[model samples]
Target chain A: MDSIKVFAPGTVANVACGFDVIGLALDAPGDEMIIRRSEVPGVRISAVHGADLPLEASRNVAGVAVQALLQKLEDPKAGFEIEIFKNIHPGSGIGSSAASSAGAVVGVNLLLGEPFSRKQLVRFAMEGERLASGAAHADNVAPAILGGFTLVRSYRPLDITALHTPKDLWVTVIHPQIEVKTSDAREILKQKVLMTDAIRQWGNVGALVAGLYQENYDLISRSLEDVIVEPIRSILIPAFHELKLRCKEAGALGGGISGSGPSVFMLSKGEESARKVADTMNQVYAPLGVDYKIYVSQINTEGVKVIG
Target chain B: MDSIKVFAPGTVANVACGFDVIGLALDAPGDEMIIRRSEVPGVRISAVHGADLPLEASRNVAGVAVQALLQKLEDPKAGFEIEIFKNIHPGSGIGSSAASSAGAVVGVNLLLGEPFSRKQLVRFAMEGERLASGAAHADNVAPAILGGFTLVRSYRPLDITALHTPKDLWVTVIHPQIEVKTSDAREILKQKVLMTDAIRQWGNVGALVAGLYQENYDLISRSLEDVIVEPIRSILIPAFHELKLRCKEAGALGGGISGSGPSVFMLSKGEESARKVADTMNQVYAPLGVDYKIYVSQINTEGVKVIG
Candidate 1:
């Protein structure tokens, strides 16, 4: 195929107690990209839509991600042109850049007759993440590429595990249209945490993974607690506490900040409860006169797929 | 049943990255107790053997545990006499006190016509834990009652989850005849830890739980890491670094301090590998002129069972 079109889903990272390690993919609010072979001997960003971003290949996330993938080849003579139709807003804390990065690598891999496996593409995609966030973190990119829930077990040698996801799991996310810079959100966190709180966090993380495997909703709800980062970062978002309380009252299992701030997510057992959570989120933000966007979707099983 | 004799399995608590939350039961080197209905209306410890311990009802771990269980009933007039035949050495860091505590509750519950579920016995068992260690932690008691691998997800409400155990999983434990007080171990650890280390720890805990459910041995090996407590606690155990290295080299998955220190445990995929790991442990400590004991057993599927 001379050209390939693919759709890459957005992701929710730092899932409650699984800060900086666990992430899940969403079905909606993704980015679509079309990558084509180029006559020139270098990668290029042909065009972009729905967002104003850098057109330079070296500066664009997709461009940098595809370059990382091509560099692994022996000959390294392949060239590509990429066009992005962005739907996920940048700085929304819902993995907008991950979609672009994951999609670019996936499309290029397919166009080259699939030289790399999906797991291998995560490191290439993570390069773009490094360019975007200054840290080559895999919490978002792994789920975006692998689909479902993922755990970055270790980073020194880059180990990632795909965890079981229940079919009934649904997500409701709201972006309050306020900017919470990732750097600032990260800066607010304390360098050290109490051993008591750390123990509590890992207990929840282990239980959450067990709940997913057993498909036990009550266990999942009890494990969705974050004592370390949420208390500090939640202050940056408007109506954060009220939104969480009302969403739980509306039948959400539990939730916290989606990634860093601005966007908050609640997980429910079924789509009906997820929609109710979205409605509750709307009610909380409406009175505050905050411009917010809501999206209710199931856990994305297919991370990035060929659309055309 | 008017009288009940029972066997309660020993356990390894704080299994690597699951400090303060996780534990697994062992098949051998447990405690045997005979609990029978007494004419009196108060708990009593009638006989003790194989170790030096208090005989008073309130002073003994098993007596304290049985008292806690009886206190839950409105008109708890039931009195019991317990005879202990201890096999697991106290302060070996392999849940020695837990075996007594768990055995007492299980035996008494059986004599009372099974009024409480096995899960309900954990809290009463934990009262014994509090008496032994001054902290009511359930890592050891939960596994001793629930069997297999167990997670104490939370303590305030006492949430426990039983994790899947691979069929071929085996354990090798070496208790170096040395004293490493639990209080000393707790006192040595810092009150706070770096966020980076905490994230790495939770990542391993989550992945370890996932590995258990999936029966992925390689993943289990990689995730059996203790970055927080092991570093400082290993200093207390003689040749701990060497034991871990030699165990891994001898086909063991990975291991660390069993509970606090002195005793070390390694997990292997099968009984044969577990035996090999035991031989390596012998090679390490036999030359040190340090007295020690070793046990090799399968993962206990049944927690505590009535013998008569």
Candidate 2:
């Protein structure tokens, strides 16, 4: 096929206890892209719609990710033009850049007759992450490419493991129309943490993975705790504590800031509970007159998929 | 049933990536205990064999643990006499005190018509741990009581989770004749750790739990890494680095200081591989003239079991 249209899903990183290590893909609020073969010998951002983003190939995240993928080709003869219809807003902290980057590489890989595996595509998408936020973090891109739940076991060699996802798991996300820069959120964290707290955090992380594998909802709720990053980063988001408490009271298993956040995401055992969580989010934020968007979706089992 | 005899297995705590949170039970090299009903009104340590230990109920770990269990009863009228046949060496770092404590509680519970669940026994066993180590850490006792692999998810209100145990998994452990006090080991560790290192450690913790559930041997091997405590504690064990290197070269999965030190343990995919790892351990330690004892056994699914 000379042209392919694809939809790439957004992701929730950190997952409470797994900071910089775990993430899960969402089923709604993604980006749609059309990638077409071009005679010109290099990548190009031919068109952009929905969001006012740079069309320059060198400046765009999708362009950077596609270029990184192309660099692996032996002959280097392939070229492509990408058209992005963005639905995920940038800096909403729900993997907005990851959707663009993951979509671009997945679309190109298919048009190139499937040269790279999904895991390899993650490496290319990481280039986009690096361009977006000065660090090559795989928490967002790994799940966006591989789907469901992913654990980045190591970063030096870029090891990623796809964890078992429970069929009943659903996500409820609320993105407040406010900016919380990833860099600033990162800077607020302490460079060192107490060994006792670290032990507790790792304990939660281990139990969380086991809970997912066993499909034990109560275990998952008990394990969804973050003693490290959330205490500090939540200060940047408005009404963060009340939102989390009310969401959990409304039957969310648990949740925390999505990525560096103005966006908050809660996990529920089923779709009905997830929808209830979304309504509770509205109730909490409505009093403050905050502009927001809410989505209740099943856990996305397929990351990037062909649309046309 | 006025009298009961039981066997309580030893455990490898910390388990590389899960410092202070994870542990697994072994099939052999455990402690044996005989508990009997007494007309007396309180717990008593009546007989001791194979090791030098205090006979006073308050001074003995097993006695203290049984006392803790007895205290939970509303009437508090029950009394017990415990006889110990110690096999696991104290200060060997293989949960020696835990076996005694767990065995005592398991035996008494059985003799009293089974008053407590295995998980509840962990709390009473932890009182033994607190007496032994001056800290109420559940890593070792939780596994000794619950069996297989156990994660101490939280210390407050004490939460324990029993993880899946792969059928083919085997353990090879070598205990060098030396004393490494748990208190001294705790002092050697820094109170604070770098955030980057902590993240990598938790990543491994999450992946290790996933590996256990999926029965992915290679994934387990990759996840058995300790970036925090092992580096410093390995110094206390003689030729630890060389032993670990040779064991891995002999096709063992991976390992480090078992519990607080002096003993080193390696995990292998099968019993044959575990035996090979034990041979490698002997090869590494024989030339140094270090007196050591080696045990090769399968993962123990039953923690504390009645013998008679």
lDDT of each: 0.93, 0.93
lDDT of 1 at A35: 92
What residue pairs are clashing in model 1? none
Per-model TM values vs. the true structure: 0.98, 0.97
Model 2 agreement with the true structure over A230-276: per-residue lDDT tens digits? 99999988899999999999999999989889899999999999999
In candidate 2, list every pair of residues with a backbone clash.
none
Contacts from the true interface found in each model, as a fraction, amount to 0.96, 0.95
Over the stretch B1-308, how does candidate 2's per-residue lDDT look in tens digits? Answer: 88888999999998999999999998889999888898887899989899999999998999999889988965467889999999999999999999999999888888777788989888999899889889877888888988999998998868889999999999999999998988889899999999999999999999999999999999999999999999999899899898999999999999888999889999999999999999999899989887899999999999998888
Q: Give model 2's DockQ, 2 decimals.
A: 0.92
Tell me the number of clashing residue pairs for each predicted model.
0, 0
TM-score of every candidate's chain A: 0.99, 0.99
Per-residue accuracy of model 1 over A37-149 as CA lDDT, tens digit each: 98786689999999999999888889899889888975457889999999999999999989999999999999989899999999999999998999888999999999999
Q: Interface RMSD (Å), each candidate?
A: 0.4, 0.5
DockQ of each: 0.94, 0.92
Report how far residue B7 has shifted in candidate 1, in Å.
1.1
